[model samples]
Target: MGKLTRILSTAALSAAIASVSLTAAADGTTNWRMATPWSGGPWLERDAQSFATHVRELSNGSINIEVFPGGTLGSALKVTDSVKSGVAQVSHNYINYDYGKDQTTALLAGHSSGLTPEEFMLWMYKGGGAELYEQYRLDKFGVVAFPCSILGTEIFLHSNKPVRTLEDFKGLRLRTSGAWAEIASRLGASTVVLAGSEIYSALERGVIDAAEWGSPEMNRPTGFQDVAKYVVLPGIHQSGGVLECQINKKVWDGLNPQQQTVLRDAAKLSVFDSWLSSSYADLKAYEELKNGKNEIVRLDPSFIKAVYEETTKWEDEYAGKNEWFKRVLDSQRTFKKDMQSWPEYRLQIGVSEL
Candidate 1:
């Protein structure tokens, strides 16, 4: 009705629009501190860094993740507690590291007794493994978990002395952990559990005769080849291992749906990047090691058969006692059995009859 009234109304509308725009721009902006157990390795640290970068990019800088390598926030083995206590908003760690807290973690982290890495990833992504993992985290530690890294078969063992047969493991002091430690003990090798950071020094100082850290790509950066001359193949003890990013439940719940989706997608991307990088690096590393002084040893077929037999027995014994272990193990085994026909059929159809 009046010139002054019209001018005031336009100004008020502009102020309201500016306020909404600012709020929308600032929404879901989060800075999360991420910790990892890997201190010096190439793959682990690189994977964590790339995952952080992916999250920030995917969220359009709304989420910023800062990663701290192993021992900076705390011991890698204690990363679970670090996330739970809110010392860190997130952590990259192997689930089996917390097996002492919940034995079922071994099944989720690294139990090679049953499935290969590809099979395990399939079960985790397509089958019900992801839900089970999330439930395990919520039920046991009050945290949220994502499978951030999945490694192919690792080096079974890197030894100072050649181990050609099952009996060669006798009296050998080996550095390993989880159910594999139990299996090593059963095989008459004295098992010593050491942190990844300590493996090189332990082997160099002759404190341990052998160790099994990861793939050639992972282990090469750690200088295991310098200390141990024998690189064993077919990492049966840790067939397909997974590293997960654990986030505080409260922090995870505080995120909006879009932020949560970015986090999950970023983790999945890290898994792909890590597997591809490590696979390529491992092939190159194998070539280097083969050309160099270190000897690559494939365990004798008889010895491998014996190890498998012992591993099966160990699984049977544990399944009888632990419900969670039995449940996860059975799930994997069933999946493996059901999928076996596909590979067999493919091989049959692809072969020429000539």
Candidate 2:
């Protein structure tokens, strides 16, 4: 689509998502409070609000969800905890936040940029990833999960210095999280851990040489470009991942069959809808940066190849230590291999063969 068309579509979707219809409570209505890690405006928050709206409509107002942006209900760090403790019946968040308890959670978020969006989507729906995700969440944290939002590829490095090559990353301090943090460390960069609010200042004060955040649209307003003039491409850290709707197990157990189905369907719908909108918006955001003061740096192909090799070694060691990691890793790798069949066949034949 053209830029103007995409812009208009994004604006319309934003406006529609801003206002969600909810009827007055009646008998049989199940009230839920959903806490999210985003304060407001970002598509992540919109994803949560959109899911709640869908649940209300699909359940015919039998389910009413109130979405609390970050810090309103609890700190971003405690979103999952809030849901588990019943302070909120549900939370919208990245599963990687629970990595302290289960390393497997990191794989679900982004395993070293392991799966591209195309492969990830196929694995999620057709390759049993949903079931594995649900099982892991319930086992690791007393909650049920449905992937409520899917992130597009993010910016790899927003830095004051050029980080286009593997050599440049050596001894460079960076701010990042999840599995990529460890991978970055092994790659000879000193990876720093910082909160979302601290990234800009960390870059401004020269505390971190670079940082990786979400998609372009999400990072634009954070003002990273003002502090760091280099915008790196192919966010190898998080090519894609899901933000989940994690429900309290007790509350989930109380849900009737139809209510449960409504929640699941709503999450699925929101994921698909958000992917389309986020992708278009992100592409538009990337295009706008073409003439900006920030210098765009593409990661060297060799750097990308090295990361793939390192990720496999790191994952293998973890798999040996953790069964869940092995299981999920196996599922993803198998699906990725299975997905290659079509491309391989197509390469061996001409279009005329069809």
Candidate 3:
């Protein structure tokens, strides 16, 4: 073949390859969706909107994702199935909502053993909890789970009456959820599981005398204070709550490596931001509630200790019955115990809290 002809043929081959690559990139970019369990609510709204915006921008407008708020696409509980069955490409839902499918999920919702928000975040992100969570999600649920947000510990009792002692909980109709309901029921509170939206009316009509929702920031909007005058401090049941964002396994596998990396990075960043921001929000809400003349009270240390002991026992019993929960909890406990002394050692050396 002539040299000129050979050069032209090579150029044509290169052009064809470039065209195929461009087509593949375009196709991959336009094919993704994320559903969130936040329906115009501030917490989920802000993060979900941020994620959708980042997804589009990072992909250079090549990738497009639509965020379907809770109930807009489906109920929060339906999200897992929606993703699994390919009805949705992705979703953000509470792990506890799926506890029926796997008890380990609810167990991970809050540490019955009392890991603070800071402790839980560190354990999940830096201390090996992520790997365990991934195993549970992938092996059991057929989903790619990411710990995207932590709404601080479920703070103390908000009620129309005071809970001065453990005995005060007896026969009290408390609105609660997840494994806490089981624990609370055992403690003699008539636990009623109600959605956040329903709490206001229930509290108003005296359907439920008390309810433990999210942190002050999360609960403030629910108008719980409007009906219940007493706000309890120092959350016990949920020292911290982990919210997960999951993508369908098949959908996740279908993405290009670059897309996968983008998602993973965004999710990790979101968690860090969410945790820090939530702390600030909660602190602000606590100040506002107290200043607004709301009756605020902290449980006595004695009561706190008693509740913690009972909660830990519940955790051990439940963990024993479920091997997966047992593994995750044992791993978390071991990791935390190994690192527990570091904070004290640093403190003794005159290390600054900052």
CA-lDDT, candidates in order: 0.81, 0.83, 0.76
Error of 2 at 327 (Å): 0.7
| Candidate closest to the true structure, highest TM-score | 2
Candidate 1: list runs displaced more than 4 Å: 1-28, 345-354
Expressed as tens digits, the lDDT of each residue in 85-114 for candidate 2 is: 776778889888888877898778876645
Model 1 pairs in collision: none
| Top-scoring candidate (lDDT) | 2
Per-residue C-alpha lDDT of model 3 across residues 36-64, encoded as one tens digit per residue: 66776755676665666666777777766
Model 1 TM: 0.86
* lDDT, residue 256, model 2: 87
lDDT tens per residue, model 1, 105-198: 8888876565776777788888788778888788878899978888777888889989878888888999998888888899899999897779
User: If both were scored by lDDT, which would come out higher, candidate 2 or candidate 3?
Assistant: 2
Candidate order, TM-score descending: 2, 3, 1
Deviation in Å, model 3, residue 46 alpha carbon: 1.0
